[model samples]
Target: MKRIQFQETGRICQVPINDIFGFMYLATFIYFLPVTGIIFIYIAILKYTKRSLIIANVRQLGLEQTRYRRELRFIKRILILISIIFITGVPYLTFFLQVNIGQSPMPSYGHRISFMFLSCGQGLVMLLAIFYADDVRKSLRNILLQKLPWIRGRRIGNIIS
Candidate 1:
């Protein structure tokens, strides 16, 4: 039998994360594109909502104002979420930019920081979601009730909701 040369199943099976080309293309497609799209969508929403409020008839002014306030709050929450995600992603991006591929050892702080962000960021995001989303909270309560029969508690009003 011919000698089987093996390192991986394929020579190019995995893209090195620090590879400049891989990083650029992946970041462009995954990070920049989605972030820019989200920003544009929020901008459009805000502009359209403002226009609608401005053009509201006297009869519907109160309703429009309520709508405007609700939309504004939603937009604010989204902005917070975006900020959190961005903040969490920064260390990784910084590390990516700081390191030259295969030239020197990658910084240990970069790996640590990225790991911390990845771990804590997910929990923070989930907490934000739980706080903001009434349905998610309700579902979690229901699941807890179903899974743990021993726990007995009266129905409680949702403070956030």
Candidate 2:
């Protein structure tokens, strides 16, 4: 995976609690990606520009850098897994892009079955990643707390309280 500078830091400065819950609620009203992007930007601004706000809100919200980082990592893993599924399957999908692939635009029963299986595979991968991610995130959070004093116990319970 490509490593970004901010992600390298053990501190997660991404989506805050309000944004997390907001996204959950927004998902009910809006399609996910756009709402998620807006939420991401909102929290990112607070972390980067509104330092005072974070400091003021941190205590009440019980947000620690460690928890933020853990959530960020979990989000990152899910995105990566989804991306991998998309990229790996792109070639197969390209066949549909053409006007013809020695067949009709309408897919055969076999093709539909294959497509459904592929979709299921992607869904399964995402589901597993979602379940496993919590464990991986907690392990990383603990490691960061133990290894980095400045970050250790700095947040509420090393994750979002």
**C-alpha lDDT of all candidate models, in order:** 0.69, 0.50
What's the true lDDT of residue 32 in model 1?
79
Query: For model 2, which pairs clash?
Result: 64-155, 67-159
Give each model a TM-score. Answer: 0.66, 0.34
Model 2 per-residue lDDT tens digits across residues 33-55 = 74466457656644553464466
Evaluate model 2: give its TM-score.
0.34
User: How does model 1 fare in lDDT?
Assistant: 0.69
Q: Compared to the true structure, candidate 1 yields what TM-score? A: 0.66
By TM-score, the best candidate is 1
Q: For model 1, state the Cα shift of residue 69 in Å.
A: 1.0
